[model samples]
Target: MMADDGGCGRCCFSFVLTSGLSALFLWLSLRTYKPSLFIQDLYVPGLNSRNNHTIFFQLTLRNQMKDKGVGYANISLSFLYNSTLLVANHTLPAFYQGHAKTAHRKDSVNAAALPWPPSNGTVSFRVRAATRVRSKIMLWFTKSHALVVAADVEVGASGEKVKKKSIKLKSGVADPGSRWLRMGVANAMLFAVFIF
Candidate 1:
């Protein structure tokens, strides 16, 4: 009878331990927050003509997690004319963002001197930004998520401030290729953890 009671206690303890770990992992997964990117402003600072001009822009990053922060490994921004011609490109400096904080960065790019002027009064281009970010939840778990955001922007050669519009890109919508790959890898890791 004593042996039976001991076995029952061990089984109960095992069940409780497994349930607690599962609950903890589920909570962490649900609470994890992803960072977002937004283009605050874009305009031409000074230009005698459209031939040779410099474009200045402001970018903002908002961290959604209240207790977690993100560390950036690399960030690359590129501007393309008509989705083919590369107009300007800039590599932003690496930085860290605190939880629930917004970081604003100002950057400029000199448009390449074209042999011929643009036919229209406004030039349209796409802005593409790729970033590698590492997110940490409290002090326990850390994960890496890759984010790529792109938007079509038009600027008037007349130096008019581009219409004030907030262009914000979220993770899964902007770059599905990398997001899917990451999801697969994460699932594999989780399977390995739980199985082994």
Candidate 2:
């Protein structure tokens, strides 16, 4: 009886171990990450009082996932002067981006909408972008998720962004639903730990 009991205990331990590893693998394989966005470059000649009436910019979109793909809908971009005055608008074509890929979009926009010239050899601007993203897992795609991100741009006497490094755009506000979902995930992870 003692020998049989030892064998049974070993079998149970192996079963639990296999189950835990399988769960971990599934969690890792199915995880998703939202793509990252950044303002790679910005040049506003109007800010420098150059009478150029043009804005040149470079935008960077990155999909950092190692295995999954990202599909973006038409991306709407807007530039606001002094955080309120609309200065320019543009739409970027939608496309599928592969994992670990980065896309750079460059454009020159007419800055006829500038309300006024900058003061003190400096200016403030807001860059906003909105898009819908879908995650491609295996052969299937997930439902579209709305993403809105914005960044503040400070232009100096040179009429270019004050920051030399790329400025990462971030979601301006968090919705209640996503906050609750994150909390729920944390709780579920704790429960799983207790079970294991």
Candidate 3:
């Protein structure tokens, strides 16, 4: 009877240990992990001015997850022109989150003179980032997100402004006929001249 009681006690101890391990594993699996966003590249095409400059905004985001589950990330970009502010583009990516791992991404944009007022052109701009932590979960594996970015800037005028002009002829010149008719007659005359 003593031996039988000892065996039963050992069995009960092992059962409690197994139950505790299972609960811990489940808790870790459902844990949530959040990430970040980044800008990668920026370029300017129509930039040309001495006092005006083109700016390229580059950004990057990095998130290391401690759990494995679906995660969401959002990044919003805004530019400050002189004293005014304008919202640029934004991006979002979703992936799995895991422990001791990182994920990354990037975005880029070129900012110049907008069509609004302030034509005198003392315009300057800067880029900023806003990030958030969405909900996360744990799974059989781990996932991560990392964001990266780079920007190229050029300062100067856009280019030479060309003015339209109206041409005037001497008053004694005869009026020319329709352009289509003149073109047809010229082509016919050229053909005749060449054939003859």
Candidate 4:
């Protein structure tokens, strides 16, 4: 009977230990936030012409983590025509975004002075924004993240309606060096648990 009781106690202890470690790993995975950029709106203010024109738009930065915020190091915007012609470039001011919050900034790109004029009937161009960000969790841990947001739009002649298209650029999350460390720690813990 004593041997049976000892075996039961060990089983209970192992179950509780596994449960606790699993919970910790799950919480850590769910609590971290990934930064994202969005182009909310883009439109031309006046008629398209050979002369210079300004493109007006709103850009939104989002922080979805409930406990973490992001600090921007640099944000840049560029406009391209036919994927090769550079139309305009602008550097936006840096700003901080709070947890579960979003910030919007209004900016314009002047493309009128392009050396190559827009093709006569319809003109299509791409707008892209790239940003470098630092995310902080509880003021103790920080990681760097980078992302790009882009969209394409085509404008018809003076009387034609503009059809805006989805952004075709593909980007991935920028995981900081600490992210690898965290992953390694998690993997080690998992291996140790399973081995023992």
TM-score of 4: 0.70
Model 2 lDDT, residue 160, Cα:
85
Report backbone clashes per prediction.
0, 0, 40, 2
In candidate 2, which residue ranges exceed 4 Å CA deviation? Answer: 1-13, 49-52, 118-120, 172-196
lDDT of each: 0.70, 0.82, 0.41, 0.66
**Poorest 10 consecutive residues by lDDT, candidate 1:** 169-178
lDDT of 3 by residue, 1-196 (tens): 9999999888876766575567556545544433333333433323343243344434433445444333444555555543355525444454433444444444444445455332343333334444333434432333433322212121223321211221111122122223334665576567546644
Q: What is the TM-score of each candidate against the true structure?
A: 0.69, 0.79, 0.36, 0.70
Indicate the TM-score of model 1: 0.69
State which candidate has the highest lDDT. Answer: 2
lDDT of model 1, residue 150:
80
Candidates ranked, most accurate by lDDT first: 2, 1, 4, 3
RMSD of each: 5.4, 3.7, 30.7, 4.4
Which parts of model 3 have CA positions greater than 4 angstroms off? Answer: 36-55, 62-74, 78-128, 133-196
Q: After superposition, how far is residue 179 of candidate 1 from its true place, in Å?
A: 7.9
Model 1, span 38-72: residue lDDT tens: 87887753332645467788888898888878888
Position 48, candidate 2: lDDT: 61
Stretches of candidate 1 off by over 4 Å are: 1-26, 29-31, 45-48, 115-120, 170-196
